[model samples]
Target: MAHAQDASLVARDDIPKTFDDVIPGGQDFTRKEVMIPMRDGTKLFTVIIIPKGAKDAPMILTRTPYNAGERAGNPKAMTIGDAVPLADAAFVEAGYIRVYQDVRGKYGSEGKYIMMYPPRGPLNPTKTDETTDGWDTIDWLVKHIPESNGRVGMIGSSYEGETVAMALLDPHPALKAAVPESPMIDTYMGDDWFHYGAFRQMMLGYVHMQTVQKGAGAVTPTDTYDKYEEYLRAGSVGDYIRSRGLEKLPFVARMMAHPAYDSFWQGQDLARLMAAKPSNVPTLWEQGLFDQEDMWGANHAWLALKAAGHAANNWLVMGPWSHSQVNGKGYNVGPFKWEGDTARFYNRQMVLPFFEQYLRDGQPAKLARVNIYNTGDDRWDAFDDWPTSCAKGCGTALTPLYLSKGASLAFDKPADAQAADTYVSDPAKPVPFLPRPVLDPFFGYGTDFAGYIPWSSWLLHDQRFVDGRSDVLTYETPVLTSAVRVQGTPKVDLRAMTTGTDGDFVVKLIDVFPPSVPSDPAMGGYQMAIAMDILRGRYRESFEHPTAIPANTPQAYAFELPNVNHVFKPGHRIMVQVQSTLFPLYDRNPQTFVPNIFNAKPGDYQPATITVLRSDSQPSAVWLPVVGKSTTP
Candidate 1:
C-alpha cells in the first residue's frame, strides 16, 4: 500500500480543498479496503487507514450507513467528497488507526437494509442485527489488524452516531470508548421521525435520499424547485408515497402502518435497548443545541445510561451547532455568530482527550460531567451533572411568561377572566416555516437556483417573516429591563379549542433583537427563534392511543421544547409565536378527524377557527427555565 507523504502525493493543488484538509500535515497513513464478513455471512465493506510506522496504536472505528470508502479509496491520501469529515487532525496526529465501514446493505455491504434495526437478544446466535454485526466487526478487526494495540473506540454523528450507540449494546472486549454524536435514539418520541406523534413531512426527502437512492452518487429524486408544492399537490402523506411509487419502501410503509407508538417503534428505540443491556464503555454523548434531526436522542440516552447505573465514564457536551456543524469548527449559524470555534475547541479540549485517556491510557480526562455552550452568552458553561446538579443549588426555576390580553407576553398572570384570541387556520394557505422565496431544494425538488441554504440554518432565521401574519399569534414581553438567562427545557401550556376534529399546535420561543445592536443592520428587530416544538392534538392524551378533539371543546395541551442555554440581553425582548401549522417542516394537519392521517384524502384538509384562551381560569403560558439573578444595571 502507498503511504500519504504530502498533499501533492494524493490530491492536486489545482483542486479546491475539502473537509479532508482538516487532517494535519506530516502524518503518513496507509489505507486498505476490504470486505469483512459478519456472523450472518453479510459482507460489510470496510476501509482501514493506519498511520505508518506507528507501533501498537489504538484503533478508532466508525460504522456508517453512508458509504465509507467512496471518496477515500486511495491509500496515499484519503479525501471525503461531499460527506463531512469525521475526526479532526488530532486523531491522525495522535497515531490512531482509523477504520471506516459501510454497515449492512449500504454501499458495498451485503444484506437487506432495515432502517434503525431492532435490538434482539443475542440468545439466538444464528440471527444477526446491527448489534451482532458491530460485535463481530470489532472482534474481527482487533484480531486480524496488524500493529493494533487491541483497544478500540467508536465515534460517528447522525445515522453513523446511531451505529456507535448500537455498538454499546453487547460491546466487544476490545471496544474501550464510544462517542455517539446526535444519534436518533427514538423515532416516534422527540427524534427525527415524529414530534409528539406528529409525522415529520421532511422525512419524505430523507427517506428518498436513503432508500430509493442506492449509492452515494445518487442524485435527489425530484427535479422540481418547489418541494412544498410537490408535497401539497400529492395530497395526503399516504397518497404522496403511493403516487411516487414508494409504497414498497419498507421503512416508509412500516412508519405509515404504525401511526401510534406501537411495539414496532418501541423495538427500534435505542434508549430502551441501551437500558436492557447497558455497557459502561467510557462513552461521551455530543449533541448540538440546534440539531434539526436528533437532538432528543443523546439526552435521553445519557439519562437512560445513568438510570441503569452504568459505572463507566459518561459525559455530555452540547454546542450551538446544527446536525452537521457539530463536526466542523464554524462559530456561526446563518446570521447568528458565536464567540469562538466551538467545534474545534470541543475536539481539542474534550474529544481528543477523551480518546487519549480511554483508548491510549494517556493522562486522565478532566472534563466536566456536562459541558455546554451557552448560545446567547457566547460562553461555555460546565456543570457537575445535567439540569439538577449544577453549581446553583436547584439549577433553574420555571418562570412562567403568560399570554396576556393585547398580544402581550408578561411575567404576571392574566388579569382578565375571559381574554381569548382567535385565528383561522387554513391548510390552503399554511404559514411558511421560513421566510418567502424558500430556496430549500427539498421544498421545490432537487434544484435551488436561488442560493442554497442548508436546512439547519433555518433554525436561526429571523421569525419576523410570520410575525405580522394573522394566522400566527405574536406575544412579546416589554423590552427587557435586564438580561434574562434561560438554561433548561421550556414548556408550553396551551388552552385552546379547534373547530376541526384534529389540529397541530406549533410554538416558537424567540429573541427579539433591539435596533441598537449593530451586528447586522437588517438584524434589527430580528426575531431569532431559540427553541420550538409541535404537538398533534389527537395524541394529547397518550401517544399510544390517540384520540381526536371534539369540535368547539376547549382542551389543554402541553409539550416540552428541547433544552436550551440562551440569554435574552437587556436591550432585547423575549417573544413567543404560536401557530397551528409550520408548512413543509411538518405535515399540515387535515383538521378533520380521521383514523389515519396518512390515508386521509384532500377533502379531509379544511380550515378551522382556532381559539387560544388566555383567561384567568385558563392562562396559556410558556414556562422558561430562568437561571441566576437578573443582570440589570
Candidate 2:
C-alpha cells in the first residue's frame, strides 16, 4: 500500500488512454479506429489505414453507409495492399492513405439515418448534410494526421459514389480530386427507383436489404427458384412488397406516398441539386453503359454540369460495365467481349494516372475531356466533348428512322399515305424482359468475369425473344452495307391510339448479328438491344403532373432512350421492337388509369389494343444520330 504512492506507480495525466498509442511505427501499414465528429456533434465511425512509410501521402477517403472495417479486406489480410479493396488496389499500392467511414445513422455512426439524405436548407431540416460532414472529416484529417501532405482525394461507387458527388457542392480546400462511379443520383428520372416515373420492381428486394437495419440487413431471399413466379402471384406491386412486410419502412412508405415526380422527389434528386450550384471541383465522372441499377445518374449529372457551364473541370469515363464493374475484372459484359481487360486498363492507365496528377504536386494530367469505351467497335475513343456526333456543333442531324407498313424500319420517312401497326397489350400476359427461369440478377465476380445475360446484360438482351409475340410491333431496316456509328440518345416518337385510358410504351434499338460468327459461334444470330427505354403514358404532358390518356384517340408520345456510342457493322440489321409492358422489370401500368400505381389493385389492370401510326400527319420515327454520309442502309 505504501508503494502505491511511488511516482512510477501513480497514473500520470500524460499516459495514453487507448491501444492506438501502442501501435509500432515500423510496419508496412497501421490500422486505427476512430470517431470523427461532425458539426452537429455526431461522431461517425471511421477506419484509417496509413501505409508504413507514408509521409506526405495524399489521403483517399471513401464515405459509405456500408460497413467500413469489413470492406477494408479479408479478416486475415497480411499487408496493406492485401487489405485494400479491389477498387482501391492501384491507389493504395501507389502509397496513398486509405480511409473509410460509415455515414451518419448507419453502422457505428451516431445519428438517425435518413435514406438518400438531401443537402441542408432544402427539405432537410438538419444543418449537417454530407457536405458539412465531408468538410469536417477532411479538416480533421489534415490537422491530425502528421504523415499526410494536407491534400485529400475522394472516390467511391454506388451510394458511396453519391457522397463523393455531393462533396463537390461545398468541397473542402484540402480535397483536391474526386471520382464518382455509377452514382445513384436522380432516383425518379432514370435510376434505382424509377425510369421516367415507372417504378423499377427489381429494386423492391434491394430497398429492404439496404434499409432494414443500422447496417445492411440480410438479403431477403425470394424463397423461390424463379422471382417471376413470386411477383406474378403477388397480384400488384403494392401486394408484392407488402407481403414482404416493407410497408412500415420509412423510405419505402415515403416513396409509396410520392408516386409522381412532385416536390418530394425533386428535392431529393442529386442531378437537379448539383446543377443549381454547379461545383468547379476537378471531378472525374464514370458511368456503365449497361448499369442495371443506376444506368444514367452519373450521365445525367455530368450532362447537367456541362449544361450549367461548369464543363472545364468536368470529365467523363464511360465503359461497357454493369453497375460498378470497372472496380473488377472487365474482360467482357455477358457474351460481348472487349479488346482487353477494360477494368485493369481503366484503373492503371486512366484512374490512377488522373488522380496522380490532380491529388499530388506533379505533372499536369493529360487526359481526354471524355474517355469512352465504344461498345460496337470495342475501342477506347477520346473526345474533347461527349455526344460529339450530335446535332449542333458536329454539323450532323438526328435522322429519323421511320416505322412503316409490312413491319419495316427505314431511315427515310414513310412514303405511304397512311400506315398503322396494331397489337393487343394484356396486363396479365405482359411481355417478359428476359427469358424466363430467370434467376436473381445472376452475376459471378471471377477473373474474366462476364455477367449473366438476364441481369447484368439485360440491356443487351436478345430482342428475338420478344419479336414473335403478338403484343409487340417489330420493325427492322435492311442489312447495313456500311458501318453506321451512332453516338447519342435516340429519340423515340410514337403516335398511337389505345383502347384504354392509360398505357406504357417500350422502345428497343437493336443490332441483329449476322447469321454466323467465325470467331465466337455462340454469338451467332444474336439480336442485341443497343439502346432501349420505356415511358409511362401518364407522364406524357409533365413528369411532375400525370394525366390519363384519351382512349381511342391518336396521341403523340416522345421520349429519349438511353445514351449510345455503338456502330452497326456490315451485314447487321437495325431493328425496333415496340411493346406496351416490360413485365416484372417495371410495374404493370394497369391499362386503366389509377391515382397512384402503388395504390392500384389487381382489378385496375386490363387488356388494351394499341395502334401505332405512321403517316404525313402523325409520322412515328426514332431519330438516330448517324455519323456517316450513308444514313440509310
What TM-score would each prediction reach against the true structure? 0.91, 0.93
Residue-wise C-alpha lDDT for candidate 1, range 109-211, written one tens digit per residue: 8887777776664422347877888899999998888779999999888888898998888889999999999998897888888988888867666777688
Q: Runs in model 1 with CA error above 4 Å?
A: 1-27, 71-74, 78-86, 121-126, 217-220, 388-395, 439-452, 631-633
Residue 342, model 2: lDDT of: 89
Q: How many residue pairs clash in each candidate?
A: 6, 1
- Candidate 1 TM-score, true structure as reference: 0.91
**Tens digits of per-residue lDDT for model 2, 55-128:** 99989999998898786664345567778777788888998988999989998899988887888875788788
Candidate 2 TM-score over all chains jointly: 0.93
Q: What's the lDDT for all of these models? A: 0.81, 0.84
* Highest-TM-score candidate: 2
